[model samples]
Target: MSSDSTKPEEYLSKINEVRTLLGPLPEKSSEFCSDAAIARYLAARNGHVKKATKMLKETLKWRTQYKPEEIRWEEIAREAETGKIYRANYTDKYGRTVLVMRPSSQNTKSYKGQIRFLVYCMENAILNLSDSQEQMVWLIDFHGFNMSHISVKVSRETAHVLQEHYPERLGAAILYNPPKIFEPFYKMVKPFLEPKTCNKVKFVYSDDNLSKKVLEDLFDMEQLEVEFGGKNSDAGFSFEKYAERMREDDLKFFGNTTVTSASALLTNSDSEVSDSENKHLEDKEDEKIKNGTLESSLDTLEKPKPEA
Candidate 1:
């Protein structure tokens, strides 16, 4: 950690310092980089400019290659069919978006597809966030979970993608009703969780009133899903409806721009955007990041840059 102080002017100075260190970004790279985004990276790294720069650069590269923003709901619709994960219709007490995940609902065998769906959920959650909130809440139900559900590879990758690319975006992760047998699996995944992230994870059980109180403090029972002991009994996840919601959000995010859809465009089947037109749209998207209107974050500073 470079400094414990969090004074505003100083924080802005750090953002500028990181930008200077990063020098000029590639044309496509600036699409999501902003002062607020840089501040998140700095905060995650505890106010270190050099470390934040390196971390932010790596993320920029990942975003370019992975193109998380380009992944539309139509592409990952299959992975989400089982309702393994979806953005909850409700928000937490602080108005943060809530992402409901049920491991027992896993229906896919493709790890690659599973990861893509996770990223899609994450991006949707962020897109729906209010200007006042930068983080989202994760409500993971462990009902019917067993050893067969555990995948060490998926666990590590989840931790890496969230921590490395999303930086400080998790307000809290409620591991609700995990089985006693889940302890060993959790232990295996613990090493991949950074100390800061690990501290944000809460293990809540239905039998433990004190532990369950954590939920009461953070959520409205009426809005939370019934699986988590909440009042919402409409637990059914309709793939058609959820896909419709995601498509709506995607349209809002991309506006009239050409979206990279695996299936035909849901909004307008009659029209198609050409490659040159798509580039123009991307150029406009880059301007939004320069204007610092988009909400996104990255990594931090303090540690020495690793030897090349």
Candidate 2:
């Protein structure tokens, strides 16, 4: 933890100071290493340049050791089979990619396998992002999630990596049907989350209005699974089929393959979606995505950075 000051000028100063501390970063890491990158680290460390610098250095080391960018869908078949996570073809109202995770399907035998799959899902989601999309919306369905699926160490590591290494990649996270027993684990993990990250998290129960509206508004029902309050549930829940569809997502969005149509997704035979799904609703047209803090200057400061 660092100083509590959050003025924009203080942030910029701390950001530059942290840069001076790091001296030289890996050439390849520059894609995510810049002034804006410093801002994320600075904010995460609560305006402490020294601590932010240390965190930045550790992230650079972790990035090299993990080589997260190099992980691909083919390498994480076991995790995929667990059906715990997947990236959707559709985007939220803000055009951010949507990643679905069902903890009930946690069948991975080892922590390594579980962590690898999580990274694979993250990488594929990044790869599938459109040019304008930088962040992602996480839809975590906890229908069958219980003590058996709960790993305190794994949960803490997940929070650490996402906030420290990834930083600012999360747009919003929705927790659907979180059970009563999950409260203790929630308390443990809550302290690790940055205040900003905590604000982005929304707990959605079946009887709640927030849950119904969030699903209907940001996401296309046709693309959502039944358990998550979307239309497709039966055979559509198959991770194997979804994995194959993500390959097409990479081709249509990334460079995996060529699409003849001007609209790659509209004609995606495997998508089983509609043309309307490709359209993004205007920001002003939807109030729910606005986070109800329309006039806050601090919210303005959290605006998306220019992509590297």
Candidate 3:
């Protein structure tokens, strides 16, 4: 093997040593990219490029344990700006179909490039959903990738746009392995959503146990019956199972429940408070302008009488 090829293998051995000490990596791994790209990312992090390549290659080799049946790239197609279609095919896992799209040679910017590539694939695949099944759910898993720098409001807006465009046909679930250590921004804006639409939204941690903790903190289990119209008997399900059901059902059953009603009211009240504060500030400014004008007029009247 060439020196370049051998370097990546050397790096892989080092990564394996670290993993052995730390314990096995997470079940889901990062998506595949070129060795050069992987090397660049490693170099940026002061990591050994060869070791990263070796580790990544080992990970890829381990992925074959899942026995993903290879499908033709031509099975899935996307329309070009010139009105032509490009085709690709991905295998099905459980009930979900998975596609792996390689990024263009020009786009070698690492993390950002991967994200952009994934988004592009999702959009193109979404356009072809009509050709597939009607009641399809798209689960885009981002494994431990940090997107904390992206504005939550902007993310929410993008989600809303996707939801509106696809309606029942489209739903996105982000799985952050090792989990992103960021505050829950989705919770703040969730109330702004209509109850009917809110059913479609889910912000979940990859860890089921952590997700359970989040639910307990944010929502009352006993209130699920009174608030969401779900029977208390439903508590028998595991947190992960329950979340899956919620995503699938689109929160339709939750409509007209006490919790949804309360959430809507709270959202309205928050908006009203913001509006009131803004109005009060404007009134103060207007009053100051009027007082200044009055003072100027008084001075003119008092001083000009002698001249007249």
Best by lDDT: 1
Report the lDDT tens digits of candidate 1 across residue range 24-132: 8887887667776787778777788888888899999888778888877766777788889999888999998898889998886555566777988998898899987
- The sequence of per-residue lDDT tens digits that candidate 3 reaches over residues 1-308 is 00111233444644454444434445544333333334432432246534444544554453444211121111111112111111122222222222221112122212222222233344445434443332223222233233322322223334443332222332323222323333233343344443434553344553466654533443344533221222345333233443343233223422321222221232323534644644454344334333443232222111110100
Better-scoring candidate (TM-score), 1 or 3: 1
Looking at model 2, residue 140 earns an lDDT score of: 89
Predictions: Cα RMSD each: 11.9, 14.7, 25.9
Across residues 149-258, which tens digit of lDDT does each residue of candidate 2 receive? 65433554566567667766787888998987766556544654666777777788779876678778777778676777778665345766887886665566546543
Identify the superior model by TM-score, candidate 1 or candidate 2.
1
Q: Write down the worst ten-residue block by lDDT for model 1.
A: 294-303
Alpha-carbon shift of residue 105 in model 3 (angstroms): 16
TM-score of 3: 0.28
> Per-prediction TM-score, please?
0.80, 0.70, 0.28
Candidate 2 yields a Cα-based lDDT of 0.63
Per-candidate Cα lDDT values, in order, are 0.72, 0.63, 0.32
TM-score of 1: 0.80
